[model samples]
Target: MKIAFVANTCWNIYNFRKGLVHHFLSKGDEVIVLAPKDEYTDRIKSWGVKWLDTPLEGTSVNPFREFKYLLRIYSIFKSERPALALTYTIKPNIYSSLVSKWTPTKVICNVSGLGTIFLTTGLIGKLALILYRQAFKFSSYVFFQNSDDRELFTSKIKVESYKIGLIPGSGINLEQFKPLAFTQNTKTKFLMISRLIIEKGVREYAEAAKAFKDDKNVAFTLVGKFDTNHSRSIDEKELKQWITNGWIQYQPHSDNISNIIESHDVIVLPSYREGTPRTLLEGAAHARPLLASDVPGCREVVKNGYNGFLFEPLNSSSLINKMKLFLSLSIDEKKHLANNSRELVEKNFDEKLVVDAYEEAIHRIIKVS
Candidate 1:
């Protein structure tokens, strides 16, 4: 069987779905990729999967542009004639499903997360819901990273229950993110790994760090790239101001996420929303305690007091209070929490489990189609 993965970014596939792609290839299935090409496009081709460079404008929401995109996707789907099409992100899921409706091929759409448009009940949100309702109704299976998202889509967007499936984000590789031995270091270092965007609460984390700057024993590190497309991106000027004022130590994003998690005492993600935070799962798999917002995606991974503590979304004082609580725990207690985090991930969020489930879903669609 020929399998095709349709995504907005090749980087997402490279970062999260490499294992799934390898699993299909190992089983002697022909695998192809359909996405906008970037630096990673050639790299994926080097790994033996065929690449179809479908050009798309940057994550824009203009109706005219989106219609043009749908036409382009339809052309690609007609030419490729994949036996199964697995799509991720907004445009790929809706447009690819719409295009594949004419073919006998099965379509699997992963609603990774409902982005900014779905967070409100305004015009755009209503429009997005209508689009999702229509698009997802046609999917052979719609995979969601968290139950909260699934419920939201089912209730608000009016998607069918039987079409929905659950996955633990893209999932974390336990072998790649092994548990680190807890060692007492002089400084209680806290790391926040995410795109430096306002919606991710980057500024809130900085303010909270400033509140604790007097504590000489605790250090805060911010790691991630600046997302130019996000409306609330932390611009160069703001980032420079934060660094110059000594609010937190800043580090550029790196592919070496496991090592980054290992070096930190605690991991933080103050995101306003998520599908499921891949960083928090990675940190937990590396036996690191968490401090994240009490939002949908974050709460799913950090169980308030069990594996980690949660703060109010976008509340700097709340984040500061949680950070203080984490700092007050004894070294042994912290280690115990870290161990529990890894145990939770091992049992519920293993990367192989996600791959196996996806493979089974695709095969089932193929068998029954």
Candidate 2:
């Protein structure tokens, strides 16, 4: 069977969902990659998957541009005639599902987190929900990374519960991210690995870091690059100011995420929401304690005084309080958190679970369709 994975960016497919691609290929199924071409397209093609470039403006809300994107997606599906279409991110999920409705392609939508528009109570949020409701009602299946997201999306859109599936975020390769022994130092290092954008809770992280300015021992660090094209991006001038003022140490994005994790003590992600926080999985795999917002995807990772602690969303004070609690932990307490972190990831969030699930879902869809 020929299967297609539709996403907004080829980078997302190559980097995040590579395991799932391998699963289909290993099963002797032909896999097609569809997304806006970038540097990673060649890399993805080298993996033996066929690439079809589908142009899109990821951050745009303009209906005219979105309509064009939708039509282009429809044209691709109409021509390729894939047996099954698996879509990730916002544009691909909705637009691809819409196209599948008119084609023989059976679409499986992966709700990889609701982006900025869904977080808002304004016109954009309402508009996005309406579109989601329309496209999803016709979908073959809906896969959510966490139950909270599945419940929220299905409740709003009225989809079949039988059609809903759950996956741990694209998932973390335990072999690549397995735990390393750590020792506590007088200076507790806190690190946040994320794109520099507002919705990622960058501002909240910055504020929480600022609250610890007078603490000479603890260091607040951010690792990841600025996402310039994204609408929720942090202002370049302000980011520079944060660095200049010595509020936080900003590290450039690196290919070796495990190396970056090794250099930090505690991993933090105060994101407003997520499909699942990949960084937390990476950190936990490396046996590092976590700090995250007490929201959906985040809560799935942190089990309050278990693997790590959870704080109120958007509350810098709450984050600061959690940080303080983490710092005050005895060596035994810290070790307990680290042990739990590794155990939790090993038992639940292994990357194989996600890839195998996708393969099974695609096979089942093909068998029944």
Candidate 3:
């Protein structure tokens, strides 16, 4: 059987769905990927699957461009006619499922998060909800990363309850992210890894870091690339100002994330919302404590005061308080938090669980077809 995985970027599919893709390929199923070409595109193609470049403008709302995107997806579905299509991100989930209605393919949409659209009250939000409802009507299944998202979609968009399923946000690979030895350093290190975007709480993180600027024993590091294309992106000027102020140490995005996570004592994410953040899961897998906003996807990973702390979203003072609390912890207490982080990932967010879920869904689709 042939299966297709579609998303906005090859980077997303490569990082999040590679395990599932490998699972199907190992079982003798032909796997194809449809996403925009990026540095990871060649890497994914090297896995012995066909790669088709499907250009997408993620944040654009122009009707003509959207129509062109839809037509491109329709053409792909009509030509390739895969047995099953698993889609991620907003555009692929919405457009691919809509195309599936007229094609021989069956689509399974993954609702990673509500994103900015569902968070606001506007005409665009209403129109997006309508599109989701119509597109999901043709989808074979819709998997949500968190229960909060599932409830919201069901309540607001009225998707069929029978078609809804919940899975951990692109489960973490435990073997790949083995816990590192805990070493007490002279300085306590705190790190936040995310795109430099306002919605991700970059400003909050910087402000919180400022509170610790005078402390010689504390260090704060921010790792991620500046996304100039995103509307919510933090501009280079703001980032430079933060660096000049010596609030936090900034590092450009690195492919060696595990190495960076191992070096940090604690991981922090102050984002307003998320669809299961991979960084938190990766941090936990490395036996690093977490400090994140008490938002939906983050709360599911951080059991406040267990594996880590949860602060108020978008509140710099709240984040500063949490950092102070962490700084006050004894070495043993810090180690306990780190241990619990690894234990939580083992119990709930192993990559095997995600692979199994996808395999089961694939089997059901094949049987039906």
Per-candidate TM-score against the hidden true structure: 0.94, 0.95, 0.97
Off by over 4 Å in 3: 121-124
Residue-level lDDT tens digits of model 2 in 1-369: 888999988889987988888877987889998899887899899989999988888767888999989888888788888888999887788888888789999999988887654687766577778888899877888899999888887777888877889999978889888898878787899999999988789888999878888889988899987888976789999888878888899986777888878888899999999889889999999999999998989999889999899999888899999999998899889989998999999988999998878767766666843
Error of 3 at 365 (Å): 3.6
lDDT of 1 by residue, 90-190 (tens): 77888787776776667899887775556645555666666776777677988998888888777777666667789999888888789998778899899
lDDT of 1: 0.84
The digit string of per-residue lDDT tens for model 3 on 1-369 reads 889999999999888998889988998989889999999999999999999889888778889988998998888778888889999988899999999889989899999988666776655567688788788889998889999888877887777776777889899989889998777999999999998988889999999888889999998899998988877789899999889989889998788998888888999999898889999999999999999999989999999999999999989999999999998999999999999999999999999988878767766666844
Candidate 3 lDDT (Cα, 0 to 1): 0.89
What order do you get sorting by TM-score, best first?
Answer: 3, 2, 1
The true-versus-predicted C-alpha distance at residue 122 of model 1, in Å, is 7.0
Give the worst 10-residue stretch by lDDT in candidate 1. 115-124
**Best model per TM-score:** 3
lDDT, candidates in the order shown = 0.84, 0.87, 0.89
